[model samples]
Target chain A: MSALDALQATLADEHAALYTYGVLGARTSQSATPALYDALTAAYRRHRSRRDQLRLLVQEAGGQPVAAAAAYELDGRLLRSAQVQAEALELEVAAVERLLALVAQSSGTVREWALTEATWSATWQVELGGAAGTWPGAPELA
Target chain B: MPGRPLSRRTTLGSALAAPLALAACDIDPPPRESESSPATPPPPEDSALVAAVVAALVRAQSVLDAAAAAVPSLADRLGPVRTAHAEHLEVLVGAVPEADLPTAGAVSVPAQILPALGAVRRSEQRLQREVREGCLAAASGDLARVLGSIAASTSQHSAALATEVTS
Candidate 1:
């Protein structure tokens, strides 16, 4: 896929991730919800920077960027404070992994850019460990 | 370094790599066809109960797996829990009925993870509650000996989960 396509993919994911986090942050009922909110916002911020870089790359490649979605569907059960948080975290991990796949699919200078950005996004997970559940040394855990 | 895949795909360029990819999927070695499927076998209620007991262990393992994923702060504590479940599975598999030969299944990592202790702790507690209850239900039945064993495991799991949740 083209760099523009990869960027668009990442942006789409960003749009979804931000929404998930927003819902979770707003609705979560725990005393420590503040911590979750902080981590989510930080992740959103990092995603935004990448989105900007990808947008420029997309324009350079003569592709229009994908538009962000206004809202997302949440599993009804996740409406609860705890479930929402887990659900949002799930979305982030999925989005990150999917974009990484797009990076692997890319070529040329676009490939380097995508890969570099992918690593950066993934590294952020150290603060928020992987959704992969109890494997080994997971990074980017929040 | 930790995120690296256990067996990464080399990507031999599609066509040439297809064979290797297939090989890497851990396809089971060829199986000799059983002379015939066992039928009208004895109640093996004992074995059935044992299988359920074992399934309970796997259920617990799955729960611990999820707990570990959702909250990484308890990773150290979760390790022993995982071992306990694994050993439980091993024992149950050993005792399962002939009709219920063990089936190999996939063990996937939970797709959502948060390393921060607060988030991790909450998620783990929730999932721990789920597994503790599930394992107990799975093991409790007319097969008291087998079911009883699983109940015991669940009790241990419940104790651990409760400690974490209340704390």
Candidate 2:
């Protein structure tokens, strides 16, 4: 994948994450837990910012940024705090995969950015009680 | 997924250097019939990366083992941390040629919980640096991706350990 392709893929993931966090933030029961609502809100903002950055990256690489899907398929059973955390963990892991690809495709400052983003996603996974996986971004290889 | 390889490609004027550049790439192109040959040895930098990864895995295991033994209260939380290191060790070991595998000598752990956390955090920071350098030095894209993923995991481990220390 080219640097442009990696950026586009990351953008797509950011969009899905933004949408999912929105759903998670709105669920009254999930938000009722102390600090859960705040965490979701912060996550939503972070994704939005990342999405915007990815757009610029794609454009700079002379590629048209792909648009988000109309709707993402999220499980309806994210009722409990643990379930929500798990879902969030899944999303972060997905982001890490794309970011790792970017790291392989790009170099210099672009690679540095991708590495930082990868670290951020894995940290999010850790916050959600997920293990610091051996292969944070490349599970297929693992 | 390799995009247009931004670097490592030789220009027209550098045709004379093409052979060396091609040799730098780790994977050998398929040989024609009756020309079977063994794989080339790993470059020095790549071998160094494998050794660094092994050292990191050992450090993590040692520090976590000491921490768990010292603080029984935090032992439960340490399970996943120890497991993560072990898993990382397994994957990294698979990267090294059997004959070239580096030995990871034992490490001493701090006695107090706070000091142990600090030791683990410092070791993780060092490990992250090694992985980052390994990613930058990797000859193949796949190797770079793996090293990058490991670096990211180290970052997460540091963050999680921080929370444990604070809480």
lDDT of each: 0.44, 0.67
Q: After superposition, how far is residue B68 of candidate 1 from its true place, in Å?
A: 22
For candidate 1, write residues A1-142 as lDDT tens digits: 3334445777787777667666666676446566666766776676677678767766775778787777888766765555655675566546545554443334345444544444344334433433222211112211
TM-score of each: 0.41, 0.75
State candidate 1's DockQ. 0.01
Q: Tell me the tens digit of each residue's lDDT in model 1 across B46-84.
A: 344445445544544555565566667666766755664
Worst 10 residues of 1 chain B by lDDT: B12-21
Runs in model 2 deviating more than 4 A are: A28-31, A78-83, B1-40, B65-77, B98-108, B165-167
- Tell me the TM-score of model 2: 0.75
Candidate 1's C-alpha runs over 4 A off are A29-31, A107-113, A120-126, A129-142, B1-167
Q: What is the TM-score of chain A alone in each candidate?
A: 0.70, 0.90
Q: What is the lDDT of residue B97 in candidate 1?
A: 27
